[model samples]
Target: MSTLEIRDLHVSVDTETGPKEILRGVDLTVSSGQTHAIMGPNGSGKSTLAYSLAGHPKYTVTSGTVTLDGEDVLAMSVDERARAGLFLAMQYPVEVPGVSVSNFLRTAKTAVDGESPKLRTWVKDVKNSMQSLAIDDAFAERDLNTGFSGGEKKRHEILQLELLKPKFAVLDETDSGLDIDALRVVSDGVNRFTADGDKGVMLITHYTRILRYIKPDHVHVFIAGRVAEEGGPELADKLEEHGYVDYAGASA
Candidate 1:
């Protein structure tokens, strides 16, 4: 089984004022077949950790280490990180004005696999995955995220996750702006990806509604840029009832 390990990760971002530390020595480990949920108030650095793992230029790793199966993740380039089995579904998926979804998917698959998949099977795979995600066939011809709704954009992210089959997927606010039907479809896609085992998921979300469908194995309360608490599914139940007020006050 693959493993993603993070230890004492400190990250900084440059702002108008100056370089400001965001992630203050965050630590976590995710093993294959496990799902971890990160819940916190805004500005708690949940998304920062996700982007740092994916190697966004806006965030700098000032210290600490991140590794996938013992290979240095913080050292790899962004594309190399994807090739090494790391995927980040962003909070806001950017629109690629000129790229069709089909072309983008194929290009990304080729890059990650080091060669193009045979057109025959690749086409079939894409078709089936799209159908499973409830995505219309004609939507594939449109430019990526150009005119898509929030639900559609999130569905497309899961579509990529299902087809790409990365070892670890960091889903940041995937449930945001999704209606109940769309949420179920996306959750089903994730469940399908993890059903067989040997994959990891880091689901960063604000509400516990998605947890009803996804069922994280662990729940981490991220506050003030660190994991303030951790527990099993019960933690999420408490959060749903009490909210992040307790933790937010402490962080503030």
Candidate 2:
């Protein structure tokens, strides 16, 4: 019954010229059990909307408000946002040189829950989630994405989603760098996360391939930093056939 609401969100980032605006004025609402897919051409403010909502320091919110179940999301710190039931799977997961994957996930869970999970049960949960995502057990000891393949990094990202179980997840271009088989595997992970009928997902990507597997409840066309159109899953098929060409003449 919870809702994640975005009202006229405007964001900006620093550039050589000055503070350049990104998200012009995004307005959308996603409730529990709904999967909303955002599709657009490259450089469209798609990622900006995701990062801004996640409270990334690089993107500044010039105006507007984001709320989760009536709680002020913009007012919270980055970590606070996660604790408040918000999650973002970055397009490129950064390498953590010394942090083991197991340690990192557990630490993140601890931070979000304000307490550590029991080691024995947590280990079982991690193993099960990893197995489901087709990740190797040896990876538990490896540094986070230190030398992992693109597909592996993306799998690790969804692994966090399965483990963290946030109220709403905003995935930014997760389909990037994934081959066909790996794409299916990652899509399966996202499907598993949203199958509970109590979580929400905002999947941001350019292709409609992932949509075939994940099946968004709603599809949105993002252009010029704002949502140009919103419709059912049929909109994705149109994008696949016609591409974003019809939506051209708009700048990001």
Instruction: Provide TM-scores for the models.
Output: 0.98, 0.98
- How would you encode candidate 2's per-residue C-alpha lDDT over 51-136 as one tens digit per residue? 99899999999999999999999999999999999999999889999999988999999999999999999999999999998889
Q: Give every collision pair in model 1.
A: none
Tens digit of per-residue lDDT, candidate 1, span 1-252 = 999999999999999999999889888999999999999989999999999999999999999999999999988999999999999999999999999999999999999999999999999999999999999999889999998999999999999999899999999999999999999999999999999899999999999999999999999999988899999999999999999877756664
Candidate 2 deviation (Cα RMSD)? 1.0
Q: Which candidate's lDDT is highest?
A: 1
Which pairs clash in the backbone of model 2? Answer: none
Instruction: Output the lDDT of residue 107, model 2.
Output: 94
**How well does candidate 1 score on lDDT at residue 182?**
99
The runs of at least 3 residues in candidate 1 whose Cα sits more than 4 Å from the true structure, single-residue gaps closed, are none
Residue 191 local lDDT, model 1? 97
